[model samples]
Every structure is written in C-alpha cells, then in structure tokens.
Target: MKERVQKALDGIADLVWPRICAVGACSRAVDRPGRHICSGCYSTLPFYAPGGACRICGAPVAAKVSHLFTCETCTAAPPCYERTCSVLAYEGVAEELVKAFKYNRATWLAEDFAELAEGAVRAELDSHSVDVVVPVPLHPNRQRQRGYNQSALVARSLARRLNRRMDESSLVRIRDTPKQSLLGGSERRKNLKGAFSVVRPAFVRGRAILLLDDVTTTGSTLAAAAEPLRAAGAAHIWCATIARAASTS
Candidate 1:
C-alpha cells in the first residue's frame, strides 16, 4: 500500500537523518524513531520514583506510608478528583517541555508528553475503568490566540494510545480568568471559581472520566475542572498530568 511505503520511506529517512531533540538548548541528534528527545536528555527528566509521592494527589511526600498514602494537605482537604497520576516532577527538563508545549506552539511535543505519561495513566486505568478522556478546557480567547489547546493535543494522543474515546466539547471554560502562575493556591482557586461549566451533562453523567492536563501545581486547576464534572453527575473523575510542581514546603 502507498501508506505503508511512505511509512517505510520515513523510517529509512530517520536512520539517515536523525531528528533533533525537542529541548531548545539541547539540539543533539536522536536516533529513536518518532522521538524528539535524545536518550541522554530523556534520562535527565525528573521522573517520579515509585512510592515517593502521595497516592491521592501525586505530590511528593517525605515518605509514603502505604500504597494509598495521602499527603497531609490532601488528607485535610481532599481534591475534587478521586486520584491523580503524575509522570514527572515539574522541575528541570519536565518544566521546560511543559512550557514549550503550552506557550511556544510546540504542538509536536504532545506525542512525546503523552508517551511519557502513558505508564502512569495505564497504572491508574488498571484499577478503574474510564469511559472518557477529557482535557482541561482553555478559554476560547486563550485558545484562539494560541491556535490550540496544549492539554487537548496531549489528551488526544493519550486517548489514541489507550484506545479510549476523547471528548473535548463536554467541558468548556466559560470565564477568562487571570493566569494562575502568579497566584497562590487559594488565590488560584478563587480565580477559577465558576470558570468551568459542563455543557453536555448527558454525555458525562455516570461516566468515569480521565481528565488530562499539562502540569499541576496546587491542583487547583484540575480540581476546578473536576468540580463541574462532579456537579454534572460524573461517576468518578481521575486526573493525569505530565508533571506536578515540587512541593514548596
């Protein structure tokens, strides 16, 4: 078939001309097919070590008490979502990749991000069945300016890899809130209050949803997004993020 021939040609070309790493400063040649980050650079990513994070929020804890270890903060006030699976700590290369994919229009990195997060996602999915994959929605104005929603792109790739249906329209950002990067956790929660609305309640009710996002700090954004879903009668909501910010305290 012509499609097969083109794929073969592309594979051959990759061997002949290695692709450059996605990291802006580290443009070294990568030999892996369909991978933009070189193995050496990839090794430097801040992958979360097993049992080092809170099971509930995926935040790094001093030491995990059990498989269901919940951090003190999460134990005090649980997030809207049932659980979170984070692939990397938001520092070093992980932070760089998220920023580039989110703000610089480096949409191609979505596949790479999805691949990195796939294992954690699968681990979570193994215990609970998710009926739909939903990306944290971006305000129309912000999405129009960026030309794409970074989370949606990654969610689409993840959905394909997991063989799940992706629903991007059910969740909508109704308010154009201030950037959360500059705000503290409480302030960020306030900013996102009433910002999200589930437009299609029928599609989500009684369905277990896998919510996707690029990065999570205090989890305010993911929690806010899940609030509307919870109100709409979503059976259960679980969140996945490429990276989670290192605990400040």
Candidate 2:
C-alpha cells in the first residue's frame, strides 16, 4: 500500500510536470517510459529499414541482395567487425540528435537514443551472438574535457537493455587522433591506425563482442577500433551505431 501510494504520488507529480521532447518545441509530450522524445518528433527521425541493409556492414543494398549476400563495398573491402546495425540515417533531426549527444554533451539523450536503437538492433544483436558489449574508447584527455564519452553513455544503456556485460575499461585509446570528420577516407584510416589498444586481453579473448558507436560515417573509426579487439582475441566483433552518415567527407 505504501509503495502504491508513492507510485500514485509520483504520477501526480509527473502530471504537474510532464516530460517534454528533447528537441526544440513543437511541444510534444514524451510518453515513452524512460525516453525523452515524443512519437511525433520520433516519427520524423530518419530510421533505416533494417531488412534492406547489408547484413555485414549495415549499408543499404539493392533489395534483392540485402540479406542474401555482402554488398559490393564490403566484398571489396570488408570491415573489421563481422556485422553492423544502425538505428537512423544521419540527416536532419537524426543528425541533430547525434550532434547534441556529441558536441553539446547532452548525456541524458543517450538513454533516449538507446531506447530508440534497441528494436533496430535486436535482430543484429541476436545474429551476432555477442557475449559482451564494448564502447569505442575516447582519448582520456578528450573524455576529461568533454566530461563524458558519448559512445560509452549510449553503450551503457544498450548493454543494460540487451542484458550484456559492458566492459568500458577493456578498450583504451592509446593515441589521441584528430577528429575523423575532417579527414579523407584514407587519412581517417591512417589517423586512427594504432590509436586503440586492449588493456585486458583476458576479458575479451574468445568472447563475441558487440562494439557500440554513436555514429558511423565512413566506417574507418569502427574498423580501427575493431583491429585492437581482433588482436586481443575477441572471437568475433559486431558493431552498432546510432546513426549512419551520407559521407560528409
């Protein structure tokens, strides 16, 4: 009875102070429990159709070959991770969400992104056979300056939703490379090479790892991060990003 009374009280208080959508006012109320975005705004967000994307790289492929085979790009140069999934396209409102999490340090948005991502990622997560979740590491100095690693924040929520153990400490950014956004494809890959390392091989060895990133543009960052895990003997590495960009570089 006491617990019920507290629940009722909380509900009453919430009614007085309803949760608003994270995006600037169209004044839509957030009704999804533990998420900040409302249905109307969320519907406008550019979500990828999971079924029509490459099973290996999450790139959109011709409808006939989507799940049946690797896309031509992946066939020519396969990424380090075995498979990938993304929740949204990196455009318009979706891009704003990612930028808010990244540059603006809207840490609370991670929860909302994770909630949006779970359904989009569930099939890939299931297919990947992951035993652990790992977030791409940010250089310690950058993390210190930013006050948080947005990738890790998203990964933490994703791990909780998927019931996987999250190992934030296993992956370390050994070198602080410049932002990949400003670089060409080759330059991005070159910059990220040897940037990451595994602090604890024992933790990852023989485990299927799910790597999480907030956004993937050219796949260079994810590939670079996966190499260290591969060397550490992670049996298989799968990746998921909240958004996929149309290659700004």
Output the number of the TM-score-best candidate: 1
Residue range 28-139, candidate 2, lDDT tens digits:
7787655678888988888866447666877675454433677777889887789888889888888887888899977779888888767767865673377888999899
Candidate 2 — which residues are off by over 4 angstroms? 1-13, 50-52, 62-67
Model 1 spans > 4 angstroms off = 1-6, 12-17, 125-128, 247-249
The deviation in Å at residue 108 for candidate 2 is 1.3
Of candidate 1, the 10-residue stretch with the lowest lDDT total is 59-68
lDDT of 1 at 108: 79
Local error of candidate 1 at residue 203 (angstroms): 0.9
RMSD of each: 2.2, 3.0
TM-score of each: 0.91, 0.89
| Per-residue alpha-carbon lDDT of candidate 1 for residues 158-245, written as tens digits (9 for 90 to 100) | 8878888899999999999998888887898899999999999999999999999988888889989999999999998999999888
State the weakest 10-residue window (summed lDDT) of model 2. 59-68
Superposed by TM-score, candidate 1 places the C-alpha of residue 34 at a distance from the truth, in angstroms, of 1.1
lDDT per prediction? 0.85, 0.82
